[model samples]
Target: MSAPERIPPRGVTTDEPLAGLLTHGELTVRGRIREASNAALYCTVAHEGREAACVYKPVAGERPLWDFPDGNLARREVAAYEVSEATGWGLVPPTVLREGPYGEGMVQLWIEVTTEGDTAELLALVDGEEPEPGWKAIGFADVGDDRTALLVHADDERLRRLAVLDAVINNADRKGGHLLPTAEGRLYGIDHGVTFNTENKLRTLLWGWAGEPLTPEALEVLKGLQDALGAEGALAGRLSALITGAELDATRARVAVLLETGRHPEPSGEWPAIPWPPV
Candidate 1:
């Protein structure tokens, strides 16, 4: 099939309007984003004379994971967005699941963030090495061939909040590339299909705050999440539709642990602490 028409990111403000379109819009595949491991189509969605840019990940296109159940990655992606919204952190862009050209799939509003030059340089800094004043070094790793690479994350408050969000979601695949930076300096996290596992698979590149005390602001957010997940609440109900009961329970457990510990988690070392090809 031919790709859908391309629509630039302009006047795409507010989630409700975009979300309504994703839920009930006409989606056309614009092009295939070749960088993704699974099939991901870039498309323009139109509804009621309005148009927006979005990425579509059809369920049939998903590569099965041994640990995760089949045919549900799309739903998990939406669940991550729900958690982000509930916490009011806005770490995730607006996303939703609906029938598309390729059957049921995930449709999320595309975020146009920094993808070259200065942004790349900031993320590639060596670990333990100070970042240009405002930035902070989180962790470092050996990138083979006797070379060591640092895993530095932005020290901005928004990025730090996202680190906590990843921990709660059990995100097993938070590569550096998943962190998107907007023109206005806001950071957004994307590609959350591998999240919400019952296991302790919180692997990511945002360990800069490891073992450090959780800021008051972070603790408050955690508390809010806990409340939102209470029995009969909308957030809890939404999550139930996407992940298993055990996985949902485990997510709450993780939040409780974080609340009790009041600090960033250290790597368990049982599994790979960081994702391969980090950036």
Candidate 2:
């Protein structure tokens, strides 16, 4: 069957019933998303006359990672969604774990977005030593040859919230291509398979706000997550099922440190701060 004509829910942005559409629906693989490193199937999920587009990445098709344990990326994707919902940021697209044609894997509602650049509308590679007024500098990038370009991201609140989310999840890869900005103005982040590690693996293109104080709104959300991810806390209970106990504790500790610092984190200098093939 062809992919669904209509898009599905945007994770926590919509009502709860849409999750039902993704969770229990019949999934049909229509095509393969070739750009993804793993086997990402473009599919349509339908249930009780409700149908929407989604992506299914089976565990069997996943490439083994040296750092992360094999066969657990699906759960981490769902865990990322859970944390996104917890923050009330709705950064991740709605995701769930279920059995698919290739075996159990992660299924996420496919978010329809505008045709922008290689990444989202929030990032730009401009020729300058400093970012303009509306943009925040993310350091310089070696474009090619011997020339370098100044990398800057828009000074937007949504991206800031996602930066915080990345820190909380310890997201190892937040490339420009991972950003999804809809025509309607809402932004979503995807490809969370390499997240929630126990180590400080936060790497991304959204480092424009580094060392800046967290927004008041962001601090309030983090305050809520601190409680939700505590021992015996509701978020912690759910995460325990998806990630290892050590990873969960690491997640909690990351949140605590963010709250204590009250600012965006600076790079540790021990690890490569930016991802390769950045976009």
Candidate 3:
């Protein structure tokens, strides 16, 4: 059977179901993986001969301690990915919120496991163990040999553009595991729950060319992204409303800074490492 034309949800952006495509049944939760911050069982789901995976976040509706308010992190994640799709960068894959038996969470396309091994093995390669030539691995690590050209080729234009955005947003969780290199030589970035705000949480290892001028191609991409993001004021406004007043103002400051300077300032120890528990 042919797949239905996928359409993003309208009106209330939060918790928009994936239409009749998903049925009310036990979603086989294989590979129940867990991340550092959120307490959820991530697993792969299959349907109509197509397979995808999602982070099964169990929400008990309890308020948790964190920077951003509780009961809104998942929603922000959905919105961010949706806006990323609109940006036309393909930085983040398409995602939608689904109603699970436990609690409502997001369901995004499972990144095709193309890399040969886990992030640890990839880091081992960075440690001079070298996982063959031309293989790319990604995760959260400092900006050193762990992120050298082996995992990400120096000439990969797409990743270079993504690095710019990562710098601007002050992404804190750019570990080696969050990067996925496809067989077609394209790289996909993931785990963007902390961005858009302006708390100076910037921490990444892709600053090999810091203070250097963006390539003409990369500059064009960034300018185009800013324009596209401007048109979709609805997306940004929604995200801003979810965060605090200071955070919103900070996000605006960051946006302006990115537009003007086009270079991320050095990292600062202002905000905490993680957003909060139950994230």
Residues 3-68, candidate 2: write the lDDT tens digits: 444544455456666788788989999999999999999999988777888999998898999999
lDDT of 3 by residue, 1-279 (tens): 766343322211232243223333236666555444564566655454443454554444323637544335555455556555544566665555677656776555555645552333323324443434533333233447656333332335565666676764456665556766665544566766655544577655444445656666655655665554453555456555444556545554565666577553444546543222201
Give candidate 1 misplaced runs (Cα > 4 Å): 1-14, 114-118, 127-133, 142-145
lDDT of 1 by residue, 1-279 (tens): 444444455223355666787789898899999999998999988887667788999998999999987338899999999999888878888889899988999998887865532356346666455555666675666778997766576676876888899999999988888887776666778999998888899888877788899999889999999998988778999998888888889889999999999998988989988887787
State the C-alpha lDDT per candidate: 0.82, 0.87, 0.51
TM-score for each candidate, following the candidate numbering: 0.90, 0.94, 0.64
Q: After superposition, how far is residue 186 of candidate 3 from its true place, in Å?
A: 2.6
Residue 231 in candidate 1, Cα distance off native in Å: 0.8
User: Which residue pairs show collisions in model 3?
Assistant: 138-176, 138-177, 139-175, 139-176, 139-177, 140-174, 140-175, 140-176, 143-205
Q: What's each prediction's clash count?
A: 4, 0, 9
Estimate the overall C-alpha local distance difference test score of candidate 1.
0.82
Query: Model 3: which ten-residue window has the lowest total lDDT?
Result: 7-16
